[model samples]
Structures are given as C-alpha cells and as structure tokens.
Target chain A: MSFAHFSELLEHIRARRSPRRLAVVAADDPHALEAVLDAVRDGVVEPILIGDAAAIAILLRRLGERPDRFRIEDVADPTAAARRAVALVHVGEVDLLMKGRLETATLMHVVVDRSSRLRTARVMSHLAVLEIPTYHKLLAITDVALNLAPDVEQKHQITLNAVEALAAMGVVRPKVAVMAAAEELNPKHLDSLDAAELKRRSLAGDLPGCLVEGPISYDLAIDREAVTLKRYASPVAGDADLLVVPGLTAGNLLVKALMFSAGAKFAGLVLGAKVPVVMTSRSSTALDKQMSIVLAAAATRELVHG
Target chain B: MSFAHFSELLEHIRARRSPRRLAVVAADDPHALEAVLDAVRDGVVEPILIGDAAAIAILLRRLGERPDRFRIEDVADPTAAARRAVALVHVGEVDLLMKGRLETATLMHVVVDRSSRLRTARVMSHLAVLEIPTYHKLLAITDVALNLAPDVEQKHQITLNAVEALAAMGVVRPKVAVMAAAEELNPKHLDSLDAAELKRRSLAGDLPGCLVEGPISYDLAIDREAVTLKRYASPVAGDADLLVVPGLTAGNLLVKALMFSAGAKFAGLVLGAKVPVVMTSRSSTALDKQMSIVLAAAATRELVHG
Candidate 1:
C-alpha cells in the first residue's frame, strides 16, 4: 500500500525484520549525525558513520551517545570518506548512502567515478517527496535539486527514475502530472511542448508504470475544484501522485514554497543510483533529514522484500 | 504607504475624492459583472459595460440590478467591444480596463494595435501580488501570465515594468529578488547567468529605483532562518518585495503553489499598458477579481495624484 504521510513510512520501515544499513559519508556534520541518531532511535537504520573518527566520536559524545555504541569508519579526508562509503556499498555492507558535512560534489564525484561500482546505467535524478497539508496524499516532485535544466531526453530519464522509485515504495501506476505554466500547448513555452511529447510517449507505453497527464497547471493538478471549474478531464487532475516540473528552477521554487510557506514537511533522495542517496540541503530541518533516512530505509526494505 | 493586504487597497481607493471610470470589454460575463458590481458597491470605480446590451441587461436584472443603473456601451461583437474599450482609453474616458468574456488575445491585439493609441513604450507584463500568511509582507511575482521564456534583455524590461508598478502602489525602492534554483552563479543554468548580469547592471545603476539581489533561491528570498543557516548576506533575503522569476513557467508555478498550497490570497494586473488591465483567468475566484479591480483603482489614484 502507498503511504499518505511521512510518519507512515517510519512505520513501514520499522515493520521490517531488522534495520537497514546506512552509510553516512563525512559524518562529523552535527545536523546529519543528529538525524542519523534520531533514525537509529526510531529503529529504522543501522548507520555506519564514515569521516574523521575523532570528530564523529566527539559529536556523538556531545550528543550524549557513547562512541562504542555505533560503528565509526576513520577517514579524515572528505574525498576518502566518500570512497569508503562507496566501497561499503560495493561490498554489500551498506544499503544506502547519505551525504554529511562534505560538499555534494565530492561525494558525487566518488559515486560517478568510472571505476566506482555504484554508478547505475540509468541517469541519477533527485526526487522530493512532500507531505503538504493542503494536498490529500503525499506528492513527489522530481529533479528539483539536481539536473539544472534538463532537456526532453533527460526529463524522460528523470521520469523513469521517479516511476521506478515510486514503484519501490509500493505506489503502482502512480498518476504523474507533467507540470507547465498552462494546460494549453503554447509554442513559445518549450515546457508545454515537452509535456505533450511525454504524454504521447506514456500513452504509447514508452514511459511505463504511470498514468501521465501533461501541460497541466499547478492549480488544476492539485485542486479538485479547479479541475471542475476548468472542465479539465484527466484521471491525474487534482489527484496527481507525482509532479514532473519543467526544470530545476520551477521545481526548487515549488518545493520550497510548499515547505516554507505552506508548512509542508519534505524528504528527498537521489534515485537512479544503485542505492538511494539522501542528499538534503544543509539548511534542511532535522526532521526532514530524519524523514529522508526513514524513506531510504523503507525503500530498501521494499527492494529486498521483492 | 504600500499595501500589506488586498483590503488595504480598498481603503486606499475609497480615500480618493472621485471614483475612476473602468471600461469592461465584453462585459456580458456574469463573474466579471459580479466583481464590477462589488467594486461599485465599494465606491472605488464607475464601470462602463461594453458588450451585448440585451444579454448584459438580462444578466444585470438576474443579479437584481437595473441595466440603466450603469453606463452600457451596446457593442455586441467581442472584437468590436475590444476596439471600443481601447477607443475610450484613447479619449481618456476610462482610467483602466478589465477583460470579460472575450479572448485575451483579442483584447491584447486591440490594446497593442498600432492605431489603438493605448500601447506604451514598455513591454507589457503580468504582476501577481500575494499576501502569504507566512511572509511578513506582501510579495509580488512577475510575468507569470504574459511573457514566456524571456531573455536577459526581456527580463530587464520586465523588472523595470514591475518596479514602476510597485512604485505606483507606493512601494518606493522595493527589494527585488531575481529567483534561481540556487544562490550560486552556475553557468549551465542560464537563469543564474541572467541573474548575475541583472545584479551587475542594477549595481551599475542601469536598473534604477530598486535594490536588486540575484541568484537567490526561494527559501533565502523569503525565509529568515534559511538566510541565517546558509549565511547568505543580502538585504533582500527574507524580506523581498518583488520576486522576478526566470521565466513564465517558474513564475506561474510559484504563484499557483502559493495560492493553492500556501493559502495565499492574490490579486494581479497587466502593467505597461496606457491603463492597468485586470486580466485574471476565467476560473479566478470572485474575490480575486474584486481585489484586482480595487488594485487597479488604487493604482489609477496614485498615478493621478502623482
């Protein structure tokens, strides 16, 4: 069954036989470690902290946790810590990866390295899952934090990645709304044109496991009254499970607006990787980071169960 | 003083000594007439209805009002009604225009017609003003419904138009935030590049009467905590008055997300015309339409007083 709230994901993960292994690269970051510890207390994840051991121990002790209570990998340098995290993934010692105090580029560099076994054939894309109070169900927005200005091909890949990730979370045949400024296919707006093409491909069974609707405005996508008022007929209208934004700019703005202005709680991860990657911004709240850990663990459980 | 809420705009307009004449093109539409009637009751505008006279009279009677209570221009054809509205503007018989049953393109065609005498030297753009509960003050987002994928030069023009519109609303030297996916100046995202250039030009005194900050994310633009967390130093951060979007897609999505998800109340008008135009969508709430009328009347009062 699909989850409606982020809290539901924690229950789903906890029902599993045991906690999933999570590797925190450059794990001395205070906020990241706090979230990891919160998830550990929630009995969802068994985190392997990879960073400066002294720093991690100091942070853990400062938080009133014993250093010997958790696994700590001593890799002082951020790049080496990223490599160590990737190695743990390759050896099947970790089920997922989370970025900590290190720069995202450093961690991503190790993941995408030619020799790294973590690279998947699919293009890696970020998927943000938001629990917006105004929306009836959890909504997923894609490529918000990654893929600056993806073209049609990249958007196609991103859609595939999101669909697969959603499937792993038990949301079969999710309704996907390819977002644009308006419902009409205006030639001046490439987003509308791309949306039409994506919908066509979806109808032809090219993009699978999702009922895709396109060139739909945000109001029509989430507001049932708007759907009725505008006379827009689509199964996805006002009940979209996934919203594929035109680009990162729109996606980022939409996600943050919901979180900051609409009081939405969010958790996001990088999909299309061999393992889900928790890459929330440094400015993200502690609860958001904890939710990401729970989401990663839940997705991992689904994959293993299958 | 600038308006912090739409209700304040009504006060500003009602304070005026005389009501301004408003021309409603193709005014047989019920919702449009309802809003016009509301404004009339509020004593902000004297509306001249230009459309099918018999249908307008029937609608007025249905709404429990007499047709002769207001001036009625008997132009049945939508195109001819648009022309008549522009002609009234040319002769200074009306202070503003509002779209009714006719297509926007038809009204825009007449307004931009070479002989229409209503075209201004500036590029016409749509400005949406929102009063979000989470934000301390009103925020304005631009070019959501008008410009599609504006280039750097067009963005510069759009910013100028927004600045002028804000000034007319008593917002002097407003803080303008050029929105991007992230605060960093990334070359791959042309929005960031354009934002950097806009900031440079603003600092160089090319764009005047505003404090411009660019390459700023939505969170930093409106969230004080995010600004402190990210250590982003900008006067506009967390207190932006105007948010200049990268293009129409982002702007539309941003505005709709705030209105639909964040519970924001919004009113918008088309600037750069000889008179402000209330061009809200057909599905816009009656309250929004009424507020747009109030906004237009207040802006007209400001212009006359200046």
Candidate 2:
C-alpha cells in the first residue's frame, strides 16, 4: 500500500496489533516528552524514558500526567542515558531507539560503538519523509543530516537505506530520483556521472527494491508539468517517491527549503542500523516528533516481520 | 537604492534617459519575440532582430505587430546569427546581445570565443534575479546557467560578476551570502572551506563592492527568524542581495525551486562579458524574458557610464 500523507502513516501505526516500545535516550526534554506522551495516549508507542526519572516525571506532570503513569529510568547523566537506551535495544527490550535532549553525537557514538551491538554492516544514513503541499505524495530525501560528501559507493548505500525504509512503510517499489543540476550526463559534473552509474546499477538489480532514474534536474524530478514541457520521460520523472540528492549541501538546502519556505511537514530517522532511530531537532514541534515515532514504529514492525 | 521588487527594476530601466539597443540572435522564437516586443512597447529597449527576417516578420504579425515596426537582419542560420550578434556587440553597434531560438551553447560559444571581441578578460557567469514572495528584496543567484563546477578562483570571479551587476542595478554595495550546507566551517565539506576563503578574501578587499558572509546555511542566510534563532549575526544575514551558491547544481536547483515551488518571479542575464547577455530559457514566460531584458538594459547603461 502507498501512503499519500504522513497522517496515514500515523493511522497505520495506530492500527498495529500492539504498540512498539521506544527507548528514548535523555528523555528530559519537554518537547520530546510531550510527543512521547501523545504517542502513548494515542496507543502508537509504549515509551521507556531513559533520562533522569525525576525530571521526566516533573515535565510529564506539568503536562498533567501522573508521575508514575509511564516507565522511566533514573539515569541522570546524558551519556549514561544514551548507553542505557542502546543496551535496551541490544537485549531486545525495545523495538526502537530515540534521541531526546542528548546531543546526537553523544548518543550516536555509543549506538555505533562495536561493543554496543547496535551497529550494522551497512552505513547509517538519515532518511527524511516530507509531506510537500505541491507534491502528489510524501517524498523521501536522504543523507540531509549526515554524510557530508558521500562518494558513489556511499551514495549506493544511502539510496539502499532510504529505499529499504520506504519499503518497510508499504511503498513496495518506491521510485528514486538521483538529482543533479541537469538531466544530461557531463564528464565535468561528477554528480551526473554518479547518477548515471547509479541508474545503471539499479537497472541491473544492484538496487533491487526500487526504480531509479537520475542525472535529472530538480524541476523534472518532481513537477509533472516540467517533465512534460521538457519531454523527459521516465517512471520516476514527476512522480519520485524518494529524491537522492547529490551531496549533503544540496540535500540540506532542499529539505530546509521545503520545510521553512514551502510549508512542508517532515519526519526523519537514522536508518541502516539494527533498528530505526528517531532523531529530530530539539526545536521541532511535538507533532513532528509524534510523526517520527509513528514512522519508526512502522519500520520496526517491518524489521521484525521481514 | 536597493529595490524591493522586479517591478522596481522594470521601472528603473523605463525611467532611463535613453533606451538600450538589443541585438537578438535567431529572433524567430515566439516567446523571445513576445518578450522583446513587450520591452519595446514599454520603451525599455530598442531591438535589432538578427535571424530569418521572414520568420521574424511572420511571428511579429501573429502577435499583432507590423513587419516594418522593428529592424530585422536575415541571418537564417543559428550559428551565423550568433556570430552576427557577437560582431554587433564587438563594434559597439548594440548595447546588449540576446538569444532567441538558438541553443544556449550555440550563443555562448560565440560570446566566449577568444577571437571574438565580445570576450572579456573576466570569466562569464549567469546571474539570476529572483523575486521570491518570502524574501524582502530581489535575490540574485550566480553561475546558475554557467560554470558547472567552479573552483575557488572561478567562484570568486562568479561572485564578483554578480556583485558588479547588482551594483550596476543601483545596489551600491551588494551583500553576498556564499552558501554552504552549514554555518560552521568543516574540513569535510569543501564548500565550507571555499566559503571561508571567499569570506576572508572579501574582507581583505580581493572581492570588492560587496559584503560577503558564508559557510552559512540557506535558512540563516535568508530567514530573519532563523538568523535570530541560530544567533548568526552578519550584515548579510536575512537581507542578502545575492546568494553565491557553491556550484551550478546547487544554484540551478535553488533558483528553479524558487520559481516552480515557491511562486517566485525571476530575471536572468550572463555577466562578466564585454556586454550583459540576455540568455533566458525558451520555456521561460514572456514576463520573465521581459524582466531579463530590463535587467540587461540597466546593466548596459552601467557598463557604458560607470
């Protein structure tokens, strides 16, 4: 099944047989706690808050929740909290991992630690699902938060991570558009060359789960009118479920432009790990965090079943 | 004299004491002729159509214009028309060169030909002026249509070309934001390193006539709320007149996104030549082309007088 909106993702997660447990690292942040409380209330996820139990309870109570109503761990330090959360995931106690008030580097360091048992052979990549008002359906963009200047091989890995995550979310065959300045392959443009190679690899079944088209401009990738005007025909053209940007700068700008300028709503996760990791900015709204939790829940269900 | 809108640019050119003459190469395209006709009607420019006189007349007649209303040169071949336009500029017969039905490379080949008198000591770069609804004033993006992957030196030249063009358009000292993925400098991100060097050079007077800030993200560069939230203080922050993107891919995507997704109106020109060249896409609207002509007219006046 294909999701037309992020709300549908939330509804799908709500309809699951049981709520997936989330081990939230450094959960003392008010914004994160509020989202967790809402998800818990909506029967989306069961939360295991891994920060200072006293602080989490106070923040939860300030939102009019009873102190003892939710599970909480009294790890006062941020680093210790992250370690505990990772440990919970390692022992199969939690279905998902979340970053709360703690610094992403602090939590990610432990999560990727060899002894932590959370690291996978695959590279970790950030996958953002954007609900753009102008787009026909939710669009996924990858490596906007990580991978500064990914090479061709790393791009392959990044593409796989996003494709697999979307697959888990019921987009069985997502169309991926590897974007560049223009659709034509030019030797001077490394991005275009990489895109062409990626497209070739995708067609050869190197990337099995999605249809990939590349060396395409941003307008042709997402706008049907532009594709028609330019006479550029491809299955991914004008209907891309995922946009694999050339680099971090392009991806960062594209995602931020959609969110801050075009009024796009988004949820992001760090994939390619043992489990989906919900990592959002502290300034993000509670609704944004809740959507991320829902997305994570769905990915977790797929990981367990697939 | 920082104008807040493209209409101000149009009005500025219309108010000039004398209209600038434009030699439009391969001038049989309906879109290009329509825009040129509008500019002529507005008294912003005088046109010398240099393509097949018969085809030009037919298009003019279709647009309800008389065949004898404008000067027409019958160079039927695209290459010959481009050469003729370049020759007209070389001998100071026309104030600007405009591309009509010909491919961009066809015209640019003649414009940058070393044997051609239109070639200047400076490198040519595309300058786009975007009137985004959310922006406070016209935002100029550089090298969007030229210089695919400009190095640091080429970037410096591109930035200079845009700053000089904006200065000619009455912006005494244009504030340029050299864009990157993040505000902080990182060794891993070459754009950031280049941005830092450009900023240093701007401060050291290598890039004069502009206030430069860089290693800055798109949000903090244009959004005051983001600047305030991120605590990024700079004269160019939130009020940048020009955004020098890292390369062509980033710049092209940015300008196109502003146009197609953000409902922005735009005008573009090729600068750092003997004369400003109007080289808009054939698919561009009449208004877009007309604005580009106005911009080129303004730049021509500055080139002659400054």
Flag clash pairs in model 2.
Answer: none
* DockQ-derived CAPRI band for the predicted complex in model 1: high
In order, what is each prediction's RMSD in angstroms? 1.9, 1.8
| Residue A12, candidate 1: alpha-carbon lDDT | 64
- For candidate 2, the TM-score of chain A alone versus the native chain A is 0.96
What DockQ does candidate 2 have relative to the true complex? Answer: 0.63
| Tens-place lDDT digits, model 1, residues A1-306 | 567798877876777657888899999999999999999998988899999999999999999899999999999999999888888877778888999998989888888787887878888899999999988888999989878778988999999998887876778899999999889988888899999999999999999899999989999999999999889999999999999998888898999899999999999998877899999777789999999888777666434532
Tens digits of per-residue lDDT, candidate 2, B16-120, equal 757888999999999999999999988888899999999999999999999897899999999999888888876767888899999888888888888777767
- Which 10 successive residues of model 2 chain B have the least lDDT summed? B297-306
